[model samples]
Target: MDIGYILSGFAVGFLVGITGVGGGSLMTPLLVFLFGFKPIVAVGTDLLFAALTKTGGVWVHHGKHKSVDWKVVGLMATGSLPVSAVTIYIIKHLMSVGKEITGLITFALGIALILTACALLVRSLLLRKHEREVESSSISTGRFQGTTQIALTIATGAILGALVTLSSVGAGALGTIAILLLYPKMSTLKVVGTDLAHAIPLTAIAGIGHWSLGHVDFGLLGSLLIGSLPGIWIGSHLSARIPEKILRPILATLLLLIGLKFVLA
Candidate 1:
């Protein structure tokens, strides 16, 4: 057993717990840059790692009634599932052409990571704005509804599916931002819940597809899981004691650095 890989996994899991971002954004890049794994293998292994880790989170959230928006989840799945299938087909074709698909995927992952970071930063700003607006005005007791919202949700889901399938990024922070933007009236907890619910199946399906294509490294994934499971538990237990003001900026800085590294590599 490679203790280094396990320790890396623990570090990534701790970040995920601290930020609520998926492991792929951090894990895939770490594998590629720090461990010198091929980009394709890093992405494939991280997808499986994300699917497994998020499945447990989804279950816990469901048990607590705090992690799902079934209708929104269904809509996202409807759009994302087909897009994911198409993305895998395209990746397989690129692989068949003997192209440097890993480089392309890495580049795409870097771009996606940067975009997710921006989305997170913007979301924080928007939430602050919304809170201020609410403080100045009476709160409305209405839910968002309209063709525009539905269409936007579907479009966001499609984009997430393609990005995630190609780079294993964008489905966590990016997805949540889409939800928050589309339905500002909804509680933040609900938005996160719905996003997680939708991401579980989407990542699982994509991960399985990558596995079938022989992209995933089972040993690496196992090693990651061995460390991440306990790390997540510990992080979650300690989360409330930590201050978000410090965490967000640090996470954003990490994402920015990793994104730049991947893009410039």
Candidate 2:
């Protein structure tokens, strides 16, 4: 019943709702730096938190039906799932070697954060460029190219699987940017939905692996959920009124600062 943890979750959830980034990127750092949790514990907790939170999102997206691209999700899962399994085995093996894993986790988290910041900053620009590309390209059965798009999607998913398994980051922000770049003709909302749909399984596998390694703290997870569920709901309701152009750069800057701090630490 730590009020501070609950409040932090609320804030993170609100920001995630508006920005569509920061779930794993910000939450793990907050737990590690502010709450003084171990890097592994923070990452493990956030992975499950991400999985559960995004489940609700997937439901919403599926309800809309048009927002989610199941083909994309399938391709991503195909690549990501196997990599996630291998990463879990590697991390468990690393853990058996003792305290060395902590430093590795910290290093990975910092690198992922820097990448997430850059992804956020460039996300809008990518979207605009994508729009232009879409206008220039001819309509094609309302679908992307067959083999090339699938290959890129799987490759992106493999990257996400490895990074998220290591640091519990990249499934959201980095995933968004990669998809937008690979499938520039996709609608923004569809890209988000597909990414989210893929994240549930990816995070759940990683989370469960961490749990088996005794890194997850269920009490902390529950407290975070208590605050974040309502916060995301409220933020999404209010999102239309906010100016995204102003918000994204600021968020990116904050992520850059936090990432730099972790790297320096």
Candidate 3:
């Protein structure tokens, strides 16, 4: 029922619908800096918020565009799901032993935000470089690289799993950039779809784990969803009309500044 929370959610959701990033990267920081929530609670609440908001995106991409690459999703999930569970277990154990982890979580969130900003800034350059590398490779080398890329994808998933569970900030911009770097041949649509598809279960599991640790704020979650759902719907419809070249750099700059504040605070 807090209008400020609702407005913040709508803003984040609108940006996410347009750029396919910013859910956790923006929301977690807002919760911490603006609303004065603890880092753990902010991350935990944002995880479920991200999961629910992105479900509609998966449906649109899979049903209408058929852009989801299930094989890649399965491979990524193979690594991410287990690691996510283990991360939750470790955090739970630490908290049970009376460890004070608020500062740790804040630092982790700051690092993740910084990485996400860097990923956003370099996304196009990374893709172009990947394409050049692909073009220069020999056929035999290509086959070997395929096998390697699969392993790399799973490894990337494991990294995301740990990062997302700890901070709720890596599964959007960071995930998309990692997918593009690994699968340079994939179309943007496929990369977005696959990333979103993988994010659903990862966030769900992580959110549930945080819930068990009493980190989630259901009231905040509900308020966010109320405005975000509509915001996403509107923003998606307008995305194609927007110039991403203009938007991304601005968004990236904002994330970078917020990240630095968290890290230095």
Candidate 4:
């Protein structure tokens, strides 16, 4: 593994563990803006990275007996998976025909980044309103059987699938926030756990699609993974000790700047 890639993996992994917002939001952008990866390649690689990294989280949560609302995850996947498949098919077709899609990918990435920044800011606001939850960890769920809510949940999943496939910048903070808005009564621990669980299949499917399209770089993926494992462990431990009041704003600002650079470039 390249030392630089390992370092990047560790940094991004730790941030994701600590802030719950870095897997795609930070890593994809870093690949594009910092490491000069093509937008499509960066997104594709990061999608796999997210899948691999979060798989471990799922195991840990299960081992700890943390609650995961399988019904909700199923509902969301019903919408996300099919849409993701179609999106990748379209992308692969375009690529096969030598279509000029860079503009499309770049534009999508830029928009996704901006949206991620907004989501991060919104999470901070939500946490501020619920002061006691600022340091709370884990995710759990409550009942929501309303037809409207179910439809909305599926719709959210569809949107998430499309966005993540195109930009690799959702299913992390964005998905969690969507879950929170949909089920405010659910346990925060469940919400996060569910989100994390859903992300793995969602990203893994999308990553496989990208791989078929030849957008994934396995060498780079290996390097990033090497560092991310340790980074995430460290970040999870450091989270309770760190002040959100300091970290949130800084991360938000960084996202905003990077997003603007992409869109306005």
Each model's C-alpha lDDT?
0.80, 0.85, 0.86, 0.83
TM values, all candidates: 0.91, 0.92, 0.92, 0.92
What tens digits encode model 3's per-residue C-alpha lDDT throughout 121-228?
888566546543322222223223776867887898999999999999999888888777666667667778889999999999999999999999999999999989
- Candidate 2 lDDT tens digits, 163-255: 999899989989988777776676777778888999999999999999999999999999999889888988888788899888988888888
Better of 1 and 2 by TM-score: 2
The Cα error of candidate 4 at residue 28, in Å, is 1.1
Candidate 2 minimal-lDDT segment of 10 residues: 133-142
- Per lDDT, the best of the predicted structures is 3
Task: Judge candidate 1 at residue 144 and give its lDDT.
Answer: 45
* Model 4, span 103-145: residue lDDT tens: 8887787888788888888987875565223222212322355
The true-versus-predicted C-alpha distance at residue 123 of model 3, in Å, is: 1.5
Off by over 4 Å in 1: 131-144
For model 2, what is the alpha-carbon lDDT of residue 202?
A: 98
List the candidate 2 regions with Cα displacement exceeding 4 Å.
132-146
| Candidate 3 residue runs with Cα over 4 Å from true position | 126-147
- Model 2, residue 75: distance off in Å is 1.0
Residues 89-121 of candidate 1 have per-residue lDDT tens digits of: 888888789866877887888898898778777
Clashing pairs in 2: none
